[model samples]
Every structure is written in structure tokens, then in C-alpha cells.
Target: MIGKRLKRLSPAIGRAYIQLIMELDERISEISATQLQKQLKCGPGCDGCCIQFSVLPLEAAIVAEAAVAKNVNAENNGESCSLLKDGLCSVYEVRPVICRTQGLPLAYIDEEAGAIEVSACPVNFPDDYPLSHDELMFMDSYNGRLAQLNVQYCTENDIDCSVRIPLADCVC
Candidate 1:
């Protein structure tokens, strides 16, 4: 379903795409928390999943912009994440989409299996609460949009978009 004009969109498209993604992520998180019978266990100072993770080039660039704006020089010396300062994300406001969705119940369609798989952080859903596909954040759509935006970005810059860099590499 590629549009005629979007095949040549600007690199700044990532900013807009990421903004919408984050807003939807927030709404999904809120909905998940309300639908679940238990409270979300993740909170401030919970840096357990903030380890080494790879992000798309567009995502890394967006995070890097936020880090620069906030003057967040946490130093990415190859330790987990460069944005982490004493177990707290220095660029929390502009954290990547994955960071925003951590610990939340979500669903992704297993392309090969042709089935929807729902999951969340172990700390969450401890009671084995039953959740339907609609009740969870469907990641396939959001991820597709992100990938599309990345392609547009790469095409605009004449670079390969498939490369994913570590979070530390971006923040530093």
C-alpha cells in the first residue's frame, strides 16, 4: 500500500512518524494497565531491560537529537546504554519506541506461524491474566510503519536502511 508521493519523503519524516508512534504507545500502555487486573511493575529506576539493544537508524537518530537537546552526555562507553545515568534513562522523554513499550502486554503476528502471540515482561502478567489480541498492543502495524519510515529515510539519504545500531552507539 505504498503511496505515490511518500516514496520520496524527507528524512525528517522519522520525527513525525516517531511522534505518532510514541503517542500511540502511551495510549496502548494506559489501556493495557487498565485492562490488566494488576498494576505495572516497571517504574523509575527500573533499568533491568535497559541493556544492550539494537534500534533502527531512524530511531537512533531521533534519540540522538533528543539527547543533544537535553545536553544529556551520559557517555556510551560500551555499557548497556549510553543514555543510562545511575540506572535512569537520561533521554527518558525521547526514548525509542521499544523503550516506551517495555514491560507492557503486546501482540505480534507470527508471520511464519500465521498466529498472534501475546507477551509481556515477566514482571508483568504474573497472574497469567487472559488477554485477547484486541486487548493488547498490536506491534505489527506500528513496526511496519517504522520500517516504512526508515526506508523513506534511507532512500532520501542514499544509504541502506536495514542496518540497526546499538543504543549506546547512537547516544554517544
Candidate 2:
């Protein structure tokens, strides 16, 4: 039953990418509650992150999976996103990585400077609440590994990688 739904929603022939997001979201929620409460106090109607071109591998997959799971038309969730409802994440328990980690700081290797600096999420305030040690390690381990999913989608169909369209525009 799950396999058939995934086959339809999944961009590739055999990739359960949405499951990854579902797992990560649960982990992040427990690991970053203090930070979420103190700094990333985002409430309803604060979807600044959604407006930008930042579709993490798992996020795109869950939206796709939700559509297929529901037999939605147009390869769309038809609800902006299966997780989103009235400016809130209805599926917060199994929300996507974008929602879980969006309210946090991001540190990346500075190729030029060779240093790691804190880059806060546009909707988050890391200066007020820094991430813990375990959180950093978990994020590091979760390195952006969705590049393959993109390649798989492109190889399977005529997917436009550069298209960063809005959810409202894309949803059926």
C-alpha cells in the first residue's frame, strides 16, 4: 500500500525521500525546543522562508508524497502543502525539515575564509539562542544529501531544477 503511494508521489522510481524528512522533523523538534522557544518564536503567518528558493530535498519529497498519497491531481498537494494549513503546519508532528530546521542558525564551511560563522535563518534569531552541541553534530550528519534525488527526478522526467516557484503557484 505504501509502496504504491510512494511510486506515484515520489519523483524517482524508487526513492523514499519523504520518509527522511518525516524522521528528521521529529528529531529536530526534540533537539531544539529551547532554541525554538527562545529565539525562533515564529507563529502563524510567518512564512518568510517559504517565499524564498529553499526547497530542501525532503521538503519537496514530502509535498510530492502527500499529493500521491492522496491521489491529488497535477502532481500537487492542492493545499499549498500537505503540512500547511491556515499559515500553520497542520502536520507539525511530521512536518518537513524546512519547518523543523528553518527556525535555527546555519553554519557552513567558508571555502574562501576557511572558517565557520553563524548564518541565521531569515525567520530565525540565532543570536538570541545558539544551537547546542548535539544539534550541530546531528545537522552535520544530515548533510545535504538530496542532490541525488534531484538527479534522479531529472533523469526520470523533464523536471526543471532552477524553477523555484511558490507553493501557492505550484499546488493544485
- Name the regions of candidate 2 deviating beyond 4 angstroms: 1-15, 33-40, 43-85, 90-96, 121-143
lDDT of 1 at 67: 66
Q: lDDT, candidate 2, residue 39? A: 57
TM of each candidate vs. truth: 0.81, 0.57
Top lDDT: which candidate number? Answer: 1
What is the per-residue lDDT of model 2 for residues 68-138, given as tens digits with 9 covering 90 to 100? 45544432334345335556554344344545666566556665897666656655653565566554414
Worst 10-residue lDDT window, candidate 2: 1-10
lDDT, residue 45, candidate 2? 69
Give me the displacement of residue 155 in model 1, in angstroms. Answer: 1.0
**Taking the tens digit of each residue's C-alpha lDDT, what string does model 1 give over 1-172?**
0111123335479566857776676777667657564547777888888887878776676676676667766565464676788888888876777888888777888989998888777777754677665567777778888888888777776656877866765543
Q: Candidate 1: deviation at residue 116, Å? A: 1.1
Each model's C-alpha lDDT? 0.70, 0.49
Per-prediction tally of clashes: 0, 0
lDDT for model 2, please: 0.49
